[model samples]
Target: MNALARRNPWLVVACGAFIVTLAMGVRQSFGLFMRPIGLDIGIGRDMFGLAIAFQNLLFGLVQPFIGALADKHGAGRITAVGALVYAAGLLTAASATSAFGLHLSFGVLIGLAMSATTFVTVLGAVGRVVPAEKRTLAFGLTTAGGSLGQFLVVPAAQGLLSELGWRSALIVMAGVVSLVFVLAAGIAGKPPEAEEEGPPQSLSAALAEASRHRGYWLLNAGFFVCGFHIAFIATHFPAYLTDKGLDAKVGAMSLALVGLFNIFGSYLFGAWGDRWRKNYLLSGIYTARALLIVVFVSLPLGNVTALAFAAGIGFLWLGTVPLTSGLVTGMFGVRYLSMLYGIVFLSHQVGSFFGAWAAGYAYDLTGNYDFAWGASIALGLLAGLVHLPIRDEGLVARPAA
Candidate 1:
């Protein structure tokens, strides 16, 4: 598998993309379950939202360690184990009869599963295989896989909920997730001997170096905002639309549109990353998110505007993953890409915890999501500004002083 990766890197990218598609695709569908599960289980939106929030939090908390393990062992074994655990989480979620059960299944188990299966581990595999010049584009293409899953799976999930119900839908999803065990074969080996271009840095050395770098923390801060925006929108947008009196299908479609448009956005931004400065591109994406939210909230609620907003936001969505990961690779090299990027992703998930939970809390208190929307705008603008001072230069270029 390692030899095949060297000979044909695109294969590794394709397999990695599929793994993310299954993982994120199912994840993206969870929002659809919120209303139904809340009604059936006698829980409020706050409870459901908290569970999802915890999932994001644990997901981020464990990534650094998971990435380290993947770095030391290999992505294949980690991903395979994650696939089984993800299936178990889904099956367990189906059996959940209370908020505690939901938290145990969806929050703890699935969170850990995501750390193993999603972008951090997958992109690390792709980074080692693809040539440096094409890495950003490859990452973009790979990131697009999650969007593609959103595009394809959210609607399917909605249909399953309507037809077979949430429990059965999750069961079906578990069956789908198990396929990753097979795809794992593609990304199935340790980093090749030639993959690392320099004398090796110890994992502790990598962590210490990142801690001292001002720009690295800045990246973490910016990504935190990104997490907030995505989690708030993905988890609550459907419910928000329903609050506006639109049908539930509109909410599902809106999310699907987000996935659909993001496919192009991910590719374009990735291609752009290879040519232009990544930090500047990141700033633009975040700033655009702020503007989009402002316009979305200011306008009167309607189906057309709702779907349009989904398309607009979706295009800007997930573009951050590639550019941010690219910056880490450029600064530190791919030898520890999984671990460093995992640390950055942990910050993103921390923000996700707030975005998911706070919106629900606000909604429960105020009967509307206005506060969450306002906060998202503020954070987006801050993120846009924060990226400006980041130096995108490689590690060797930094002064010892």
Candidate 2:
């Protein structure tokens, strides 16, 4: 083991966790700003949703390339550039009055920035440092860090928006994201020594190999549903609550509840992924999500029901992340984890584009989110069925020791 891994494993996990927290925290807060930003700029909800959709699209598109770069070079430079770009995007977004500016700031810039800083990059680093036996738990902890960020930052952003103006809130968030530089710096140590065996595989070859695996495709397809469900709820739930004649704070609290409850949900699922059959567990999660969404949509809109639904759904929310990544590492070796996982994540963002944009589009055309809710249910069931056939064992190589 290298000095950093040997000397301070917990410290490494903490630093990695912090990086994920900052990256995901600010992104999650974007939902809170949708109404204020849209109303202030005279932009339609579709316009804001389109920009966020583009952000998700580009974030997914660039992730594979960024992950490849991190695998080849190091995460430090990529993370530093990502932090700078993310901050600049938020700053520009704060000043924007046009739809084009929103697309540029929130869509392209923030999307690419998040591609560099989020789970693929951070978790790749964690995969390298932590032992194989502990890897799933380590990923679980990192994911929980992101959930904690939502738990804290969403409520904090709400307070800031109430006290300071939305523009000021954006500026404050940009400042908060700057702290990621420090966390990235701590990850700048040498690559794992075991990685020095031979020339790294080209991105094309790595992708080709992953494509040949049935499990990889199944995982990619299943993850699309996860993204669709998360983006739809995250972007639209607040508005949904308000449309039902509840206070805006109720929407915010519902989101916070999702984030808070997910902290435990992700960890529990992740631990189960390590000890049990990951594919079956994933199938169960998707099936359960289908049932949960059915129940949630059926219930009359109210504060109590909404909050309970949020907490219940939130527990299953990002729980897919760690298991999905863990399955990737299990099927393919962690040698090309970043690149392979990035490709899978690309599917996720594609689903996100449709989820975020479609919810807004459906609401605009029909004045009800019923269509989007129905779509989520259908996709959840499809995902559950698709994952059931996945072969979770290692492809050709023996399981990692």
Candidate 3:
């Protein structure tokens, strides 16, 4: 498998993309269930929000360890296990009867599953296989798979919700998630031992080196804001739309449009990263997000404005994955990318926890998402400024770990 991947690395890229599509597609669709599950399960939005918050929190918290396992072992083995666990989490979520049950199944179980299956492990796998020159584009392509899933699966999930109800829709989604195990065959090799120059750096050394790097933490801060923006919108946007008297379908389609437009955004930004300064690109993306939100909120509520905002935001979505992951690879080399990027992703998810939970908290307290939107705009601007000082230097520019 390793020999085959080395011979034609695009196969690995393709397989990695498909696995992400399944894992992330199903994960993204969980937002559609917020209203229905809240109604049927007799829980308030805060309870449901808390469960999803835990999901994001746990997802980020365990990522470094999971990425380390994939770095030491192989992404295929980890991904296969994640697929099974993901199926179990979804199935369990279907049968959940209370807040604790939802927390355990949807939050804890799926969170761990995502840590195993999503971008860290998958991008790490692709990073090892693809050469440095093409790496960002590959990462972009792979990341876009998740957007593709969002574009495709969200509407399907809504359809299932309408026709079969949330429980059965979750069950069907579980079946779809199980396919990732089969697709895991594509990313079947460990990081190549011969790739790095000079003496090999241990994982501990890599972590220590990254800890001391100023730019690394800056990347983490930027990603945290990114997570905050994403989780807040994905988890709560539908309900927010419904609150404005838009049909539920509008929300689902809005999310789907974000996915669809992001397909282009992810790819183009990735290609741009290979040529332009990534830090500038990142700053622009974050600043754009803040502006978009301001315009979105200022405009009167309607289907057209809602979908326009979705398209605008979606195009910029997930573009960060490739650029950020590429930066880690450039700075540290791909030998420990799974672990290093996983650590950064952990920060992102930490922000995700606050984003998901705080929105609910703000809503339950104030009766509107005004506070959340304001926070997102502020954080976005902060992220834009944070990226400016990052010295985008490569491994050769720094001392050996």
Candidate 4:
């Protein structure tokens, strides 16, 4: 550790927290623009959905490479570049007049930009700085920060849209994202030197090694379900609420509630992972999501019910983050956390693409969100079952003391 790292680990955490907050807040705000942007551009919801789907797809495809770069070099450079691209993408999105422009700005640019700056980069940096004993909790804290962004930014963006139009909101948000560049600078400090045992494996070898681990494959499969549930709800819930004759603000607040409650839930679950079987905890979270979605879909749609559902389901939202990342660190060690976690996140983004696009397509075909909701419930249950058999022990052999 350097003098700054040795003296002030909390400072590093704060820096990481700020970066996560900015990155997630901006990303989450994208949903607020969906309906308005579609109407203004004279495009259908599926067009906007496809654009966001491409964003998620590209985001996932590039994340592993970005992670490798971060692990090899440092997070600061990648984060800086991501912030710049993200800002430019948002600015371009604000001026978009056609479907192609929307796809270029929102899909390609924002998606590729987010690959560098989101949870993979921030969590990898946190995993590097925090001690082994407190790693899970540290992961929780950073994940909570991202959730906090979701909580704060979504409603704020909605309010902005209510006051100014969506285009103006995007312009303002672009300026705010530029601040991430400053936070990225704080992550320039060096990571702790790897212990002298054997040299760290090349990125390709490390990836190949993880590929052979059964637990890693299980983790990826389970995360796919998470992506499906989150993307479907986040992208389409507002329109769903409107379809039910509820106020649009209710939909926005539902998203905000998920973000708010998830802050505590993520921290609690993260701490639980450190003390219990992480795979079991993940299984429980998924099961809970299944039950919650069942009840949410069956209940009569109203403000009270929506808010209650949001809060209840919110507790399970993003609770997967710490445990997922913790599982990777536990199995592989933190030496290559960035690369390993990025590959896992790729599974998540692929699922996100399906979840986001499918909801719009299904709704357009059926004129209701019922099919998407049903799929979410089924996938959640499947995720729970899939993770039940994962072995959560470390990969390397331990010497007898």
Candidate 5:
């Protein structure tokens, strides 16, 4: 067990991959259950959407404090507690018979649990333990884990929703999440250090410095677009496909395809960030995303078209994760990586809250996702443009006296 803490990058990546597979996979799969749960509970889709929206907001809001705790303490124990809470939330969500119950279980509890177990904490640990250059690849691989989760879990969830009831599936998920507790211990290591490239800076100092950076604020702006894109699509795409008269299987496969393709995109993009100017590469990706969305909406709709769309979108999906994370560590030291990333993620969640809620609200209002998709396309272009002109160099610290 002690040997595991000896800076094993592969092990860290693997553990992060699996833990996110469970956490984000479960979160992505929530869309599959949305229709079934709504049908059973006699609630509107907006109710579930609002619950998920709350889940997104809460997940991001709590991450900074959790990251701070992991920075000060170790991620191992926080992850364990998070896994337990996640499992309990899944169980409680299963038993919920009211909207308020869903809000408490899925919205709040799982939100807090993910704050502990997901990217900000897990990847932060990986970034600290690995070399600086390796962080892009590590963050990429870890981000890919979320995509892989989306790919594999979506189908598994579709199968489960088809065979067992949603309630039974939730109960089964509770048991599966418990395994994260074990992985948590594997990732636990010494607290983060701020002196990777310079002498240590105080936490408050790090905060003040980051707060004053224009590039940092630009990064936040681009990340908000990313959050909006993912939240809207992940929470609503499956339902959107089915509403278009496509088979339910098509919806599941659409999500799965994104996951599989995103795995490659993430790894490739991560590798590229190491060699290229990350801001430039990020610009291209966002531009590509906009183009893809435009093409997707312009075409004649069908299973093949939907799948092709999914593949294109998936290739661009989560590719931003590694680049964004790596960019943060590149500019700032690793000491406060978790908390810093958490602040960025909070902006993302704010976008997510709107994305998830707006999709449902649009559907409730006019019975379609047109407005949401159009907004996403425009935002992609804006994000791409904003990423340009970012000064990606790290802060220059004074030479030690």
Candidate 6:
């Protein structure tokens, strides 16, 4: 390990984890607010869904540029700015009463903020300081931090909604979220000297090399499916369960279970990734998800079954982060890991847009989420096929012309 990491390895993980916990963990509960916000504003769930869909789209759209900025300028300033914007967006959401206003704040503003504060920044930091051999393990722990946040924050958000109402709760949450600025201070500056891999690659050359790799695009395709799966469940599952006559708390708890179980799942998968073929692991994950969804949908609807489904799915949740980032670094070198991972993450977010919107649209048209569930199962199978043939090897650099 580099001296910085060796001296305070836990600090690195803690900073990154705490950043994600706030960014991703807090966002997990956004779904819980969908019903209340929609009802208060006289909009349907589909309208709220559209706002969030746009948010996903925006998050993906800006990722590469933001990743480039992080690569060039360091993640410290970028992440802190993102948290401020995120806090502002939340405050905007708290005050907004119209659909367009909601989309502007909830959709565009938060989306931009998320591009900076989430995985690309956090993972890049940990991946930089940690030894090459230990990267995935570090990633798993940091990613689990996000999961842990979800496990704790979702229930707390529900309670806040009950006590303070949605608007007031958002204001309080925004205040708490500002702490990301402080946490982000830890990841500032470039990689440690001992961890540096000679000099950085030119952006254009790196982009050209990655663009030529078939494996890169395959990874993108597989990741797109992951985005779809997460968005569908995270944004809509709460509403789905409640619509079935289960209590609203059941929905919150289900999401919490996903977060809870994923903590272990992420760590275990991270450790396994150091030893196993990442592609095979990804294939298994997708296949398992498909099988679980089929069983969950087939079973009678109840909290126990729902929690079981959540736990099963959650264990697989975000486990993909360490694996996917590891693949990028393994194939392309860490010089531009943030940019490359961000592009792949953009693909994931693209799927997110469609997944979240499709669920709401299906509900609006059919009065149930059957169509969305079926689509999710199909996508899972397709993602498994996509990952099966990825050639996990370094791309040889062609002579520069």
Please name the candidate that would achieve the greatest lDDT relative to the true structure. Answer: 1
**Candidate 4 TM-score, true structure as reference:** 0.96
lDDT of 1 by residue, 137-207 (tens): 99999999999999999999999999999999999999999998889888989875556657767778888
lDDT of 4 by residue, 149-257 (tens): 8899889899889999989999988998899898887675545456312355566677777988999999999999998888888888888888789988998899899
Lowest lDDT sum, 10 consecutive residues, model 5, at 392-401
Across 87-192, the per-residue lDDT of candidate 2 in tens digits comes to 9999999899988999999999999999988898888877777778888888888898888888888999899998998999999999999988878876655466
Higher-scoring candidate on lDDT, 1 or 2:
1
The digit string of per-residue lDDT tens for model 6 on 159-186 reads 9999999999999889878999998888
Q: For model 3, what is the error of residue 39's alpha carbon versus the real structure, in angstroms, after optimal superposition?
A: 0.7
Off by over 4 Å in 1: 397-401
- Counting clashing residue pairs in each candidate, in order, gives 0, 0, 0, 0, 0, 0
TM-score of each model, in listed order: 0.98, 0.96, 0.98, 0.96, 0.96, 0.96
Question: What is the Å distance of residue 254 in model 2 from its true position?
Answer: 0.9
Question: Which pairs in model 4 have colliding backbones?
Answer: none
lDDT of 5: 0.86
TM-score, cand. 3 vs. native: 0.98
lDDT of 5 by residue, 253-307 (tens): 9889989899999999998988898999888888888889899899989999999
* lDDT of model number 1: 0.93
Better of 3 and 6 by TM-score: 3
